[model samples]
Target chain A: MADARDAEIDDLINNLDRDYDFHPGGKDNAGYGRDQADNKQQDLQKLLNLWIAERTCPDILPYDEELISTLTDRLRAQVEFIEMTTTDPEAASQSKLKILLVESELERIKFLIRGYVRARMHKIDKYYLHLSTQDTDTKRKLSDAEQRFVLRRATQLKRFYDQRFLSSFPQALQRLDDNSPILPMVDTPDLNEFVFVRVLQDVPGEVVLSNDDSVDLQKGNIYVLPYKAIRKFLRVGEVELV
Target chain B: MALPLKQIGTFLPSEISFLAENTSVSIVPRQALDVLELIGLNLPAMRPMRRVEVPLWVAIILKKQSRCNIIAPTWLSEDSLKAAYEAEASNMTRFSNKLPWEWIEVGELVLTSAPDDLACPPHIIRNLLRDIREIRQAKVRAGLKSLDPTYMQIDNVGAMELNEIRQFVTMTMNELRVLQNGRAEEEAEEEVEQYPGEDSDLEDTLETTEYSIPRDSSNFDDSLRSRSRSAAPLGERRPTSRAPAYEDDEGDEEEDLEMDESYLHTVKDNSSGQR
Candidate 1:
C-alpha cells in the first residue's frame, strides 16, 4: 500500500509537471489549457489546505474568506476559459480576450494577497496587546483563546497566499519575455589586486600605480601596461583601506 | 426805532431813505453778506464806507441764495423758531423711528432697502444722523467696535446688525461643537486602541514560540550542519577507514600501505558513486 501510495504521489507530481509544462531548469512557460487548469486547481487546493493549517483564530479565519472567494472566482474563470478553449479552439485562437481577462484577474489576486498580508501584520501588533496585559487567570484564558485563533488563521492565510503565488508563477515567467534589458555590461575587477595609494596633486596623474615587486609609476606614464593590469594597479579615486 | 442819518456812520443817504420806508425791518448781519459771497451768491457790491440796514425782502433773497449757511435765518421770532424746530424735530424723530423698524423687518428677511429710502429725506436728516450715532455706540458696547460707519446706513444697518449677532452666536456654537467632537473622537480612538482581543494575543505568542522558533532553528541547524560537513574532511588530511586493509610482512608497513590503498580506493569509489 505504501509503495502504491508512493507511486501515486510520483504520478501526481509528474502530472503536475506535465500539465503545467513546468521545466525545472528552464523558464516556466505554461499556456492556458486543460492540463494547466488542473494543475492550477490542485496548487490552489494545496495552498488553501496549508493556509487552513496555519490559521489558529476564528476571527482571522473570517478575514481570509473574502480573499479565498476572490481566488476561487479567479480559478473558476480560468477553468471556464480552459473548457471554452477546448470546445471552440478556432474561436479561442482568434480571441485574446481570455488571456487578458486571466492576466487582469492574476494581477487583482496578487494585489489582494499583498493587502491581506499587510492587514495581517497590522493585526499582529494588536494581537500582542493581550499577551502584554497583567497576568491573571481570566486574562490568560482569553489570551490563550486569542493566540490559538490567530495562529490558525494566519497560517491558513499564508498557505492560500503561497498557493496563489505558485499557481501564478508559470504565467509570470511567460510574461517576463515582454521585459527588455536596461543595463550595460562592464568587466568586473578583482577586489584583492586593487590597492589605494596617495599621489601629489601636481602629478600628471593623481593615481599611484604599484606592483607586487614594489615597482611604482604615475598612472598616466603606464601606457605599456595591459588594460587589465592597469585596471588592477590603478585606483580610480580616494578609498580608505579599512 | 428811527435813528438820525448822521448817527448811522457811513450810511448812504439813499439806503437810509429805503430803510425808513419799510415797516418790517430785516437786520442782515454783516456776516450774512460774507456768507452769501462765499456761497457764490450774486449780489450788488456795496460801498465799504456805508453801513445800512437792508430791507426784509432783500435779506430773504440773499439768505435764500446763500449755500454757505445751511441753518435758516435767525432773524425770525423765538415762537416761530421754536415752532419750526419742534416741527422739524418731530418730523425727523417720526421718520427715523419708523424707517429703522421697517428696515429691521426687511433685513430679517434679507431684503435690501430701496436707495430712495436709504437716503434719509431732508426732513429726517438730523434724526438719521442721531440714530447712526446711537447704532455705532451700541456696536461698540457689544464688542463689535471695528464695525464700519457705512454699516449704519439705512441700506445695510438692519442686516449688518442681525448678521453680526448671528455670526457671534454661530461662531461660538461651532467652536464649542468642534471641541466637543474632537474630545469625543479622541476618546473613541483611545477606547478602540485599548480594546483587548485576548485570543489573538495567545495565538501570536504560540506562533512565535512554538512554530516560528523550531522552524527557524531547524533551518539554521540544517545550514550549519551542511557547512560543517562540507568543511570537515577538507580540514583533516587523515584517510577515512571503511575499506579493506592490505596485509604485509611488516605490521606498521602493512598498516601504512593499507591506509594509502584505502584512500585511493575510496577516491575511486567516490568518483564512481558520483557518476
Candidate 2:
C-alpha cells in the first residue's frame, strides 16, 4: 500500500526491476554465482543511497520497510553463522581469514543501518510537534515503530509542559500549534532549503528557479538547487540528493 | 541534541573515507581462499595468482595479510593522472570530468595501503594527484565567487571538494534566499513608498544574479515591478527579526553578481552520488 508521496517512485522502481535482466543463462555455476553477487551488491548500493539521502535532506523520508527487513534478516543469519561456526577459537587459516572478511562487512552494513535509523529518529523527534498535528498524509511518513515513538513523545511533551507552566495559562494560550503570524509556533521543516541534487533522468519540463533563472535537469548532471523546487522529482526518483 | 543541524547535515571526513572504502578494486590472491557469504557483498573463492574484484576495504585486509596484490584502477595510472592534470591545467574556468567522484579518497587509500601495486612510483602519482587537486580547487573557489541564491551548476565536482564547500555554500544560499524573499516582500509591502535607495539595490541583485540563466537582459526594465510581487510571501517567512539584516546583505551581493558566466558550466556528466 504505497502512499501518494512515494507511489510514483515505487512504481518506477518496480518497473526498473521488471525491466532488469536477472540471471540470464543461469544453468552454469559462474553465471548463477555472478547473479547472486549482483543482487547483494544492488541491495548494498540501495542501502547506501538511502542512508546518504536521509542524512542530507532536512525532512524525514518514508521508512524503507522492504530494504530494511531484507537486510536485517541477512544480518541476523550472518551474525548467527559467525557465532555458531566458532566452536574452536583457533580455526583453519582460510576459515579464520574468511571470518575476518565477514565480520568487517557485517560491521560496515550495521553502521549504515544504524546511521539511517538514527537520522530518521532525529527528524521525527525534532518535527514531532508538526508531524503529529498534521493531516494523515503527513503521518504516513512514519513506520509502525516510528508512529509509536512519535505518539509517546507528543503525549509526554504535552504532559511535561502542562505540569511546568502551560497548566497555569488559559486553555487558548496553552496551544503549541498557535499559528503565530510573524513566526510559526508549530515548527515545520523549511522545504526551500538548498540541497545538492543529482539528476537521475531527463526532467521533462523546465524548473523556474527564480523569476530570472530556469534549468532543464538532464540525466547525469548535478545541480545545487532548493529542495522544494525538486521535491516531486525526488519523490518520483528523477533526482537524488548528494 | 544531535551536534546541531548544520553539523549533522554534512558528512565528516572519516565518514567520507569510510564510504570510499566500498569502491571495488581488483586483487590477485597469493593463496587460495574459499567463497564466503557476507551481508552486503558475497566473496568469491580466490586462487593464487588469479585476479578478482573486491571492495577496497577487503583488499586492504588481504593486502595486510600478504594474501593479495591490489591492482590500481586504470585511472590511477601515471598516464591517466598526467592526462587529467593536463586537462585541469588547460582549463581555468571549469573542472575536468575525467576523474571519478572519489578520486582523492581512492588515490589516498591505495597510496597508503598498497603503493607497491601502483604502476608508477607512489611519490610521482601523489604529486600529480596533488597538482590536479590544486587546479580543481582553484576552479571551485572561482565558481563560489559567483554564488547566487537561486540555482547553479556543479558538474564534475568531487565528493570531498563538495563537502569542503558544503558549509559555506549552503549557508550563503540559504542566507541569500532569505535576503531575496525579505526584500521582495518589503518592496511589495511598501509598493507605494518604493524606498528609492533599497529598491534600487534589490533590482540590481535580481537583474544580475537571477537573470544570469533565466532570460535576456533586455527584459530587465519591464519586469522590475512584476518580479517583486511574484517573489514575495513564500520564503520561509524570514523570522521577521532578521529581515533588516538580510536587506543589508543585498547591498554586498550586487558586487558578487557581476561574475562572468563561464565559471559554472559544461564539465561533469556522470555523477556517481556520494560514492
User: Which candidate has the highest TM-score of all?
Assistant: 2
lDDT of 2 at B99: 94
* Tens digit per residue, CA lDDT, model 2, B1-275: 43344346788877888999999999999989888888778887899999999999999999998889999999999999999998898888878888998999999999999989988899999999999999898899899999999988888888888888877887678767766765565455654332223324433433333324233323445344344323322211222222344455455234224111111110111111112
- DockQ for each numbered candidate: 0.01, 0.27
lDDT of 2 at A230: 92
Residue ranges of candidate 2 with Cα displaced over 4 Å:
A1-32, A88-93, B2-6, B190-275
Error of 2 at A162 (Å): 1.2
- Cα displacement (Å) at residue B89, model 1: 49
Clashing pairs in 2: A212-B214, B156-B268
C-alpha lDDT of candidate 1 relative to the true structure: 0.33
- Model 1, residue B272: distance off in Å is 55
Best by lDDT: 2
